[model samples]
Target: MKTPVVYVALQQFCEADAAPRQRLLEAGFEVRQNTLGRRLRREEVPTFLAQADAVIAGVEPYDAEVLAALSKLRCISRCGVGTDSIDVDAAQRRGIAVYTTPDEVTEPVAQLTVAMILALARNFPQHLAASRAGRWEKRTGVLLSEWTVGLIGFGRIGRAVARDLSPFGPRLLVTDPALSSGEAPDGVQRVELAALLAQADVVSLHASRPPHAGALLGRHELASMKPGSYLVNTARGHLVDDAALVEALQSGHLAGAAIDVFATEPYTGALSQMPQVLCTPHVATLTRASRAAMERRAAAHVVEWWTQASCLTPTS
Candidate 1:
């Protein structure tokens, strides 16, 4: 009997922790991992995953065309919480089950969001630049307690951010379709998106990216924000329009911005050149514990699905 193959397409997996990959081996599946140490390009995906019966996926594109090419692929176990990279509807049509480790990444992402808010509030980038250049300069910064923060989504990550920021005493405004009128948590006000944008001193994004929609914060939305306020996004990159944000920063409408995710990764864009912008390489969920947990959960999903499939198949 031929052993079923599971391909690990995540750029970094099971390096510090081997339990996830070990579990796959003990489950009697041959496993393959990306050796390039980077995200696989769209064209390279099919070639690498040609013989895989399942894939432990990353942010690499798995659109309809890619899903159709992986003839043997039966399931995709995502290492983190976003389906933006995958064509979920197409996967369903192709009989491929899609799974994500949503809960495992919540704490890490929330922690990053808080850190970005603090960094921007205190102008960490400007301070660090002067210190690095051997010049002693001090920039006046605002206190979190003095500002009102608007959270764009009320999901697991959004709630976690609210919890962490509550003790800091910032007035919290939340706008989510799920949070109806009079449904907000204690100390949090549920407001419309326009109200939140207008009232917030720090507008943070924790919302899911809508499918096939334009940028959530275009020119009009960015313009509506409180002057000299900050923006933080640890969510999907497409939520904010890059050009619009750049314009806002240039005009001094926004004090600063901290961005972790970008529309195109390995980002070398205008924002990176802006001193006020604190850009991270989408490492919000890259903490050791979070990465290990997410990888294990994703691996377990693949094994569970494969085991069930094997049991259902007729013996030769």
Candidate 2:
């Protein structure tokens, strides 16, 4: 019998470490790594995925067309928590199992969020830039305790961020239509989006990116925010409208913004030119421990599904 082949379409940045590849080999998979040297285009993914028995996918699109092409694909082990990149309904329709490594990424992402909030609150980026330009600038910035933090979604990542922020003593307001007051983490008060928007001195987005066509923060939402309020997004970029955000930042309606993810990745646009805005390559989950944990869990899931084929159907 031929050994089952598992294809890994992880982004190029993810392949630099050898642990995931080695883990797959140790688990007896005939691992076929990236065919394209870079992030695969939409047209390129289905061609390679068609022959794969399983895949560890990145943010590349795996829509109905790609699903139809992957006749042998049993499972899609997502490297991160976000399933916005994958076509979940199409995968379900095709009887393919989908798993996201949410637990692995939660703490790291939460830590990064706290770091960004601190950096923004203290004006660290501006001071650093000024220092680099031979100017010793002493800029007074707002303290975290003086601000109200509005967490847009109270999911695992959001709750983790709230937990980390508890010691800081900022008032915490969370808005998530899916979550009831009882479901909120202790010390977090559930509020309407408008209420959160009006009161929060720093607003952070932590919502899931559903493929649905609507901006989570549009012109009206931005307008609702207090002038000089800060915005931070560790969530998917589309959650906030980039154009509208850029306009708000330019007009000084927003004091500053820190963003990790962008609507279109490898982002180069108007926001990139804004000095007040701090940007990080979508690397909130790139910590050594988190990366290893995610890969290990993803590899283990694939191995378990392959070994227990009779008990677990592709659909499950």
Highest-TM-score candidate: 1
- Residue pairs that clash (backbone atoms under 3 angstroms), model 1: none
lDDT of 2 by residue, 1-316 (tens): 4577888887642444677677778867888878565667788887877778899888888888878877899789888999987889999998888988999999999999999999988997788778878998888988788889999999999999999999999999999999987988678999999999999999999998675666799989998998899999998988888999998999999998999988887889887767677899898998877888888788777877777774544542
Tens digit of lDDT per residue, candidate 1, span 101-170?
Answer: 9999999999999999999888898888788789898898888899999999999999999999999999
Runs in model 1 lying further than 4 Å from the true structure: none
- Runs off by more than 4 Å, candidate 2: 12-19, 35-37, 310-316
Tell me how far the alpha carbon of residue 219 in candidate 2 is from the true structure, in angstroms, after superposition. 1.8
- Report every candidate's CA lDDT: 0.93, 0.86
TM-score (all chains, Cα) for each model = 0.97, 0.92
